[model samples]
Target: MNTPLPLNQIGQFDDEADVVILGYGIAGACAALEARGAGGDVLVVERASGGGGASALSSGIFYIGAGTEVQKAAGYDDTPDNMYRSMIASMGPDQAELIRPYCDGNVEHFRWLEAQGIPFERSYYPEKTVFLMTTHGLMWSGNEKVWPFRDAATPAPRGHQVAMEGDTSGAAAMFALLARCDEAGVRASFDSIAQSLIVDGEGRVCGVTVRQFGQERHYRARRGVIVATGGFGRNEQMLARYFPGLPDTAEPMGIPHTDGSGITMAVAAGGDVRGMDGLIATASIYPPPQLVKGIIVNRLGKRFVAEDAYHGRTASFIMEQPDQRAFLIVDSEIFAYPEIIGANHSLVDGYESIEAMESGLELPPGSLADTLAVYNQQAAQGRDPLFEKHTDWLKPLTDGPWAAFDISFNRSTYYYITLGGLRIGPDARVRRADGGVVAGLYAAGACTAHLSPDGKSYASGMSLGPGSFFGRVAGREAMRGSAAS
Candidate 1:
């Protein structure tokens, strides 16, 4: 293991607990629940006035499968092997071994969430949209239906949304988790900022130094300390240091407290970090879900990606384009009133025909026309030869009133979050550069690099999926460590 930071010499203990969890988001709440259930006294610290963090800002979708009862009820078949294969193909092979058990036990994990009072309906959201506005329980939140991944794994609607409508489901999920934590007798301190990890003489993390209400306080952890303080999307300096290529003007979709404090603390305690350059960039253009039927083209007016794929995948392809720009081409027939919320869907240019639209976009003579001609021909036959988009989303752009909406990442609608953090093993113990574990340090949630390492592979429910799952793993391990000692 890398050398650990020396113990805090000046600080004296103000309180003590068997397990101390940083941040009261889904991960920290799950960790506290598991640790308390394991008979370890748990103390959860949150920088916010109450519980919810970036997790509550999410859509509350959990990407779980492996023969879940809801999946079976929805007439979808899934298995651990298939889910594992899909995860590897989508999220990359960063920690495949560590992810194996989670994929295998996904159904059990779903039950675990339900036991925590997180409810899920059996219905599936049929629309191909960014997030569900209805209380549907299942949907295809990733590019599982698109090319390559479809052949890699058996496709299923793995995005299980809470039985709550609109964006408030995330808050609902968190409220359930917080309720479970409270019932388990997990104590929490609000508005407490964890400054650093306190290592013992033997280099085991024993506690944390926190700043609460202008006073420096030390909380001793007899078992372990879990860092779930979330990612560093809000920290512009860290963003510059790690993701220099990312534009400074890009909007971050992180909560204000997602400032990488837990990561810095773990690093000081000899923990390793990974996938620091990874981000969950999104370029959604829906809510008026009809816009999904449009075609996305690059600067050369060539259709690059299947417009029906997950918005994150669309964003990844858009960012990969030259100058990181792309446009969504749609016609007035398919256009509806804009959603007025989330991503912008206003048209930049409108035209009566393909030729006029091409000229308006200023593309080379006949380029846009030729592209649209081929797309319309294939779409008329209910086919997508180039990108193999689903037939339900394929439609000819022959109708008049064609328009183009700029869907580039630089726009106000685009939002992203840092996806890199401390590298931990399957046990959720923080690891060193040499792949050795930091004895008493654990991490979960957006604070650790696990699921959805990058935008290219990101799915809707990946954040909370791994956050809550691994939080339980970390909590159990921490309690086990304390019991052995």
Candidate 2:
């Protein structure tokens, strides 16, 4: 509520701590560990039976830059300023203050994770794929190398993946963080859901109401309460309300319990929200990186975005097309059976001539042909003058047998995540819509909007990046809140 919860009306606290963290995802775990390390009595209330909320499902990569050991071992030169310049356009000016510190402190963050026993390999994946299926440690997880960003800043591979065998390194990372939490003696209540924020007469958060087991319990915090519950991806109502452009066909990614419950609780406590309309919707057309050589045209048969753009960025434009329909036209040389099963890149048809394929797909007679005429002409010369697709992927569609894949969201599928939540300062303190701080309340992870304001702005590991980084920030800051009883 905009108004504060009166202390006299509140019931007796069933438990107490110096700081209480809601949810035990990467951010929550980090917050608990950091607070405990500072000697604050910490309690982590988790909705699941175990830790690692959505972070457990991630590729377990951190969007790190500024000359990490992995980057050095990969023989790439990077600097914090270069990384900052690369991210400014995406993060926008308001969040620009965030990039500098994150870039400068990135190497230290890597060392921090290393201290947690989460190993990181020094190998580099120099391919243009999404997540490495192999154990390679570094890859391009964002738009640093693409147009717009590249013009602003020199590119470097910043995606530092945890040393795990496969793409699902999130489990490995969370397991390690959870162990660190245990070692630090952070009290974690599993299967406990945070129902609401407990505030004092002046609207300062001091505890939380939790539903654990079969009972409703109150856990008081002498210093502060931090909400680290992940995003609202599982919440249908919130999605429909905030992201009106997101089609229902787009599947929500994350745990089933990522239902905006914590966000709603914080909002009810008067926490302001940001990026409510920001979304990360992706129809992955990579993995078969050869397919990126193709061109994606909308319903009117015009190339929308650069073929070499991040798949999520490409998909954002695709979903905005007429009827959310688009086609990926690839020559036989580049065609591969789509690796991502959920993207549903079904074949529309193959054609010997561009005219026949255009007519068959019901496009305006000359639409597809005209689009390809320019694409093929530029591509043959190792150039994409229009979209600036990297020269490395520049290949003419001169192959006889050409095909089109119907990668339309109206017909196929897209993996989506909500990127909007409680608005917070750089310190992870919840700020009201009127710009006043929600006293003693801090939040991190998906529940609090930071980086990744939209699909075009998203990077692969950005979700966990903000989650883990700010989780510690929230922890460190919460320890400074008024320790009044």
Candidate 3:
């Protein structure tokens, strides 16, 4: 457990800085950049040598909106209010307070990233995709064009991918940011592990105890300590304790060492944790987004959610089905082997008739046939009366020999990222159980829970967007405090 060290036990500090940041991922780097840019001495301690958490492993697409230069170049109109509405609709209206500021500060953050030498191509990937390629700049990374979200706000491609090829955008962005951090003169202590916060007699966090190269060293953070050590996806005990009922089929994804030590430290500092049961559970179901034209049915062979919903949303719904069972039924035309995963692993079987498909999958006879009859009927007229999938993706399944991919929550290999951590306000200050601040403690990124409360609400760039933007906010706020008296 990462516990706070009482000042009474600390005789002296071995080192000190105006701000000490744990975790040199994107959030920590951005925090250091801001704090240093504000004329504060910043020291960053990272668990990894190169210092890119789950972010470095991602595709580097950010959910930036309100008409970023990329969006404008792509010729799409966006507004802060619309972006706010769209996010609140998917992320829950209660999250408005947490995410509204990020939406409002979109353009400002984009400019800041640009100022830091990060480049975003002024282009657009017109298709709905799971990941953008090198030339792709903007795409629909969420349910912006899907059923409920479409009616919530005019659809726009908000995923601003870094100007690079392949799935290494996170690496590219991190390299650029780390370079910027160096230019700002931020001191780095890489391959270091923070064991605890150093709290003074007044119960204020004054420093941290970090172990580097087998030596325990105490470093003072005169202003504040920012925790960005990521989530508990890799901490099975935390996952079982905080959010049980996750099927055994789910595997931990994201940073391998993202074990929630920072959250544990924050809890010891009186930080209240919320949304512990929510997480980003995903089963890669797209490369050909047209798969939405298919139907997802429960064990009873009836569609439960709009197939056009975001893959995460659909996955969430599927997990709620009977026996955590569901399948993606696609006619030959729309089925493309699910480009990324679960092709042979989840392919149940193919059948020439709906009745055979049901029997082969062990569902009640005529169930799938009956369900498809209605779906095909409504789809012919280009409408979904039940789920309200967009007309663009509404097409009757007529192409021969249908195939069903086993997207059942229990049968399919589900990958999840932890979404629960220390609860913080828009200011990025760690909040106590009583809704009071944990003095001298600030956090952003996966170590703190704010945006994307659950799998259903997750958008591709939600993590990077809030992590970097609010990270700067956390940095600026941490420096506002006078050195611990």
Per-residue lDDT over 365-384 for candidate 1, one digit per residue giving the tens place of the 0 to 100 score: 78888888999999999999
Worst 10 residues of 3 by lDDT: 336-345
For each candidate, what TM-score against the reference?
Answer: 0.95, 0.97, 0.97
By lDDT, the candidates rank as 3, 2, 1
Computed on alpha carbons, the lDDT of every model, listed in order, comes to: 0.84, 0.85, 0.85
Poorly placed runs, candidate 1 (over 4 Å): 1-5, 8-11, 337-340, 482-485
lDDT of 2 by residue, 262-281 (tens): 78888888899988888888
Show the lowest summed lDDT stretch of 10 residues, model 2: 1-10
Residue pair clashes in candidate 3: 134-165
Q: Name every residue pair that clashes in candidate 2.
A: 1-268, 1-269
Candidate 3 per-residue lDDT over residues 1-485, each given as its tens digit: 46789988988888899999999888898999999989999999887887778888888988899988888888899999999888988888755777788889998998898788878888788876778766577888888987788899988888889888888788888888999999889998888899999998888999999998999999999999999888888887897787677877788877677888999988998888888777777775776777878888888998999887777787788878999988889998887777766422378888898888998888888998999999999999988989899888898998979999888888888777777778888888999999899999999988888587887878888888889997899899999977886
TM-score quality measure for candidate 1:
0.95
Query: What are the per-model C-alpha RMSD values against the true structure?
Result: 2.3, 1.5, 1.4
Query: How does model 3 fare in lDDT?
Result: 0.85
